[model samples]
Target: MPSGRTSARRFRNHVAAMVLAVAATLVSGAPAPVAATGQVAPPATAPSPAPVYPITARIVARYPHDPGAFTEGLLWHDGALFESIGLEGRSEVRHVRLEDGQVLARAVLPADQFGEGLALWENSLVSLTWKTGLAHRWDAKTLKRTGSFRYTGEGWGLASDGKALIQSDGSATLRFRDPKSFAVQRELTVTANGRPVRNLNELEVIDGAIFANVWHRNYLVRIDPANGAVTGLMDLSALATEVAATDPEAVPNGIAWDPAKRRLFVTGKLWPTLFEIALDPAP
Candidate 1:
């Protein structure tokens, strides 16, 4: 099998060229809103010398997790954890017990599709497939295969703002889509302080803020969906150090918020444990 990284790198290079071309063509418009409409352009403000940190995470609790599963998407729905695990031949959608990371129900994807991000809207669990140009919807309760949708580009992460589905394609842009129609409502470019933040993966929406993992980075960025500005940054270098002995593919990738319990959780691809964390001031 060809390396996913090789293909991914090629796609990124292509997207980069496309973005540069688009940026050069646009004469003038709102800078901050360029991402909002999926149009690449430079921001009005000049680039900052360094990225700013506005928020962070502090461990609150820790729970055991299966070290073998390569988790890609994670979210809290009702009383269980809804997860999507990747790898084309090993992809699956699982309903897990939050108390002990136990799988209560699961559905296997076709051996050809690698699962990516997941978003729960009302009764449907929308799961994206990496580079497959398809998304599967399942019955959240029964785990039955419900339907599928078509999308262009790579699917990296997914979340819901309680109103629309937010999707990341390993790009700086996050697209808002109608859950029912899968029509793009709007797109936003995420920027940290002043620079475009790309390689966004595994999205989680909490308190109206969009939290995304900056691929290959050690932190999760808090983004303003309205203007694509990064409001906060939380570094996870400590957690990465703890799991340094694990697989190289194991990186921070999962995020879920228990709004009812007011709890936030994060974990990596093949990590042995999932942690509930509290945000702290970065110093």
Candidate 2:
């Protein structure tokens, strides 16, 4: 699936969860987990133990997505969906049609740099690189790379709060940066049940809360921007299973919010479908 620095931690979290699920089934005489079938099955009854309240992603609509796109970032603004695709030699920023997933326009990055998170700051489309420590600025309307700047450390996910840029680097810490200079202004540590949450990736700022996709996981955590505490955890394990049947690397990693329509969209790396969903309390 995903490699490099975050792979080990991702593997650990995945394996630990699977082990717990299997153990619970063996002890309780419940059905065994379907991990062998390449599906990360959800709990048959109540959700797992976690500090934050459980939320379920109720699919409202589905749309086509580019199965070859290794989606790293996604956002909806005005009336369009902009996505950042990853992988060396294949990275691009695309303006996609919401109805059919047709790429209306795209800007390619250098073959050496793996693209990551994307955000819109004012009239500019800002995108980040994974290991190169470079951030590119693009004209929101033209999709042209206007200029570039440098940043410290790895870039995983990015979002804008209408004032500043919020960035994550696979760590529990989220940095608030000056949108103009891209300088770190403040940092927030995301926590759940007093424990730090790592591998934060693909972000969307809706209303005032920060919605983040935990890398390789089928869920998104909603954090309070004022305090960094996870207020809700929305599970999409069913969708994850559906997407990963053929490719195990198709991990859910994209989130976009359409404020005007009040819709939330989610998809995954190499997925062929994008789902518009609504969150509801889990039973």
Candidate 3:
């Protein structure tokens, strides 16, 4: 009989092997062979589709010189804009005016930690710190540090559904956690057109669907909440090209929706413009 320690080690090794095998299969484009027994064959050995969408997007409004904010997270509540800015020694959470880009209230993070994602739950604001494994909660109205929680992995994106919190790292996985305790409740891998779309970041939950920004790309994907399927894609290539021409470091990384006002907002890292866009399904 195996000892408890040895059994635990073996279990961990098995999990690691499974993860590596999946990664290898994804990268090599080789299908796993099937045996003689009646079993379904593996997927076809083909490269995944490129991370480009063909949907048309029109910018409804754009504001220049919005602090050149290294945007990590964005949210809109009750006619106020909440934004989280990243980079160590320069991280801040600010309440801004939606009409014109003006900081109304702000709270700065410590100098050593880079901010990543944020969400608004109840009356508090929650934010994650990149590489720090720490999540901070603040009083939304006063900007006072209310509490803190710890989580594993690199923080990338966050969203809330008026119940649980949804988060993503740089992987293809989306994790759902309890808001108060910060305990992971469930997880799922995101698939785009039958292929896994990794590097998922900057999340927003709107109308029961998960919308995420694929980091370093000019696309935002609408994911089915139940099975993580890519149902629709929004192409922001024009906005990306324009931002790149003006600022090469600008990368789209924030998304927020105001259901009451029926509006959407998007911005990028170290960007000077925050855009309000109206979404209309293509004919």
Model 1 agreement with the true structure over 15-113: per-residue lDDT tens digits: 334333333433233333332214332333221224444354558888877787888899999887999998879999999997899999999999999
lDDT of 2 by residue, 4-38 (tens): 55875664465446534523443364552443224
What value does the lDDT take at residue 268 in candidate 1? 86
CA lDDT of 234 in candidate 2?
70
In model 3, what lDDT does residue 59 have?
Answer: 76
Candidate 3 per-residue lDDT, tens place, 1-283, comes to 9998897567545533433443456568554444222222334221133432333355788875374688889999768888888888989998988778789999999999888899999999999988889999999998899999999888989999888889988778899989999999999888855667777789999888888887655667777878887665665665776666355446788898989866789888876677888776532
Q: By the TM-score metric, which is better: model 1 or model 2?
A: 2
**lDDT (Cα, 0-100) at 147 in candidate 3:** 99
Q: Each model's TM-score? A: 0.80, 0.82, 0.79
Worst 10 residues of 2 by lDDT: 39-48
- Best-matching candidate per TM-score: 2
By summed lDDT, the worst window of 10 consecutive residues in model 3 runs over: 38-47
- If the candidates were sorted by their lDDT against the true structure, best first, what order would they fall in? 2, 1, 3
Better of 1 and 3 by TM-score: 1
lDDT of each: 0.79, 0.81, 0.77
Worst 10 residues of 1 by lDDT: 40-49
